[model samples]
Target: MTSSTPLRIGVMGAHSTGKSLLMRRIEMELHGQGIPVARTGNLGRRAALVPLPKMQHHTLASTTWVIATGIADEIAAWARLEKGPVQVVLADRACWDALAYFRAALEWRQQTAPRAEREALHQLAHAHGRTYDLLLATVLDPDVPVESKHDYDPRYRTLVDRHTHDFLREENIRHVRVTSDPASQELAIEHALQLCMTEAPA
Candidate 1:
C-alpha cells in the first residue's frame, strides 16, 4: 500500500463460490472509508464472447488467454491511478484462476496437458500472483445449492474448487481462505481492510 502502485486484492474460486460477493463486500468497506478501488472481472463471460472454451471444456489456449487477459486488466486497473488515485485494485479473479479451471477440465476429461505447456502457464500465473498484496480464495460448499440461474456442472465445479486449493498449496502462495460462514466472511473483510487501511488515505 505504501508503493505508488495501488494495492492489489484478488479473489479466486469456483463459479458459484461467492468470489464476487466477497470482493463486493471489500469494495463497499473501502468506499465507506473513502478509499478508491478499481475492479476487474467477468473474465469468464468475456472469454465466451471471444468464443474461447471455458468451464469443463477449458483448453490450454483458452486458459492462456484468460490468464494473460487478467494480467492486462490488472495493469489497466493500476494505470487508472494516473487519471485519479486508486488505493486498491480489486481483481475478481486472480491470475491462477484460469489455470485451476483448466486443470479441472483436464481431470474431468481424463486428459493431461503437455508438461512444458502446463509449466509455462504456471510460471506466468505465479509471476503475476506475486504482485497481489492480499488474496482471498473462496471454498466451495457443495451442501449449498448453486442458484438455478447458473447451470454449472456440479462435478466440474467440485473439481475446480479442489484444484484451486491444490494449486494454492502446491505453490505455497499466501492467501486467506473464505468459507460460506458469515464469521469467515467478516474476518476476511477485516483482514483486507487492515491491509488497505494501513496505508490508505486518511
Candidate 2:
C-alpha cells in the first residue's frame, strides 16, 4: 500500500435511497471549493452490461465483479491525480453494497452462500473499506414513496437495507447514517464538505 491516497467518500444503501443525490450534493460542494472530484457510479448497470446477474438474481460471480470493479474505479479516480489534480473521489455504491444485495437475494430464495465464499468476500469488502476517508449509508424508510417507474420489490429492498447495516456492524466499520429527513441529508453533505476541505492536498 502507498503511504498516501486520495480522499474518498463512499455512499451505500438499497435501491431507491438517495445515494446518488447525496453524492451529487457533495460533488457540487467540492467543486465550489475548487477541488477536482471524480465520482464512480452505476455499477449495477455496468455489471448488467457484462451480462452478470444483478438485483434479485445476484450471484457470487456478479457480486465479486461489482466489488472488484468498484475498487478499481476508485483507484482509477485517484490515479487521475497523476494526470491532473483530482483530489476527492465519490463512490455512489461502496464495495460492500453488492454483498448486501447478494446476501439478501439468497435469503429471499431461502438459500445460504457457502461459509467460505461469504467470508472471503466479506474480507475483501472490509479491507477496501479501510481506505475510505468517509462513508455515508442511507437508511431505508418504507413510507417514503419511490418513483412510479421503478418496479422495486418492497421485501427485497428492505432485506438489502437490513443487510447493509448488518455488514457495517459485523465489520465494525464507522460511518454516518443518513435518513430521508432533510436534516440528516444536510448533515451528511456538511460532513463530506468538511472532510474534503480539511483533508484535500495543500
Candidate 3:
C-alpha cells in the first residue's frame, strides 16, 4: 500500500459466510508477500482473554457495546502495528456489520429501537467506519453451505443476507465482494491487495 500507516480493513458478510476463513487466508497470503498483517477476531475469540462488557445479551445496548469493543480492539492493534512496520490491520468484522446485524435482529424479533437511538448508532458506526481503508465482503453461496450452530436455518441467514446487501448498497461503501469459490476467493484476494495498496495511511 502507498500509505505508510497500516491499512485497516474490514472483512464482512452475513452470518456464516466464512469471513474468518477468508480473514485467516488473507493474513497468511499477506504475510507470505511480506506485508505485515494483524487481524482482530470475532466479537469474542480475538479478545477472549480481555474481558468485555456482557455482549451475549444481544440487546441494542449490548450490540452497541460490541461495536465499541470492536473499534477499540482495532485501534489498539493499529497502534501496535505502527510501532513495528505492519502494513495492514485486517479485522474480522466492522462496525457496519454490527449495525446490520443489530437492525436485522431487532427486525427479526419484531422489536423496534427508538429512531433517535438507532440513528445515533448508525452515525457512530459510520464515523468509526471511515477508519477502514478497504472492506472485503463475502457473498453467500447457497451451493456451498457451511455448518452453523446458531444460524442453521436458511431463512435467518437469508434475512441477514438481505439486510447486509441492502445496507451496503445504501451506503455505497467501497468494497470487494468475494464469491464462495476458490477461483473467486483468489481473485478477491488480488482485488483486496490492489485496494489495500491504494490506501494512504494517516
TM-scores of the models, in the given order?
A: 0.95, 0.95, 0.84
Model 1 lDDT tens row, 1-202: 2357788999999888899989888999999988888889999999999999989999989999999999999888867645577778999999988888999999999999889999999899988988788889999988988779988899999999999999999889899999999999999999999989996543
Per-residue lDDT of 141-178 in model 3, one digit per residue for the tens?
A: 87875765553556556667777778888988888788
- lDDT of all predictions: 0.90, 0.89, 0.73
Q: What would the TM-score be for candidate 3 when compared with the true structure?
A: 0.84
Task: Give, for candidate 1, the lowest lDDT window spanning 10 residues.
Answer: 78-87
Clashes of 3: 2
Residue pairs with backbone overlap in model 1: none
| Prediction 1 global C-alpha lDDT | 0.90
Colliding pairs, model 3: 1-197, 3-201
Q: Candidate 1: where are CA atoms >4 Å away?
A: 1-3, 81-83, 200-202
Residue-wise C-alpha lDDT for candidate 2, range 133-194, written one tens digit per residue: 89999999999999999888889999999999998998788999999999999999999898
Per-residue lDDT, model 2, residue 22, is 94
Provide backbone clash counts, one per model: 0, 0, 2
Model 3 lDDT vs. the true structure?
0.73
The regions of model 2 sitting more than 4 angstroms off are 1-4, 81-83
Local error of candidate 1 at 77, Å?
A: 1.0
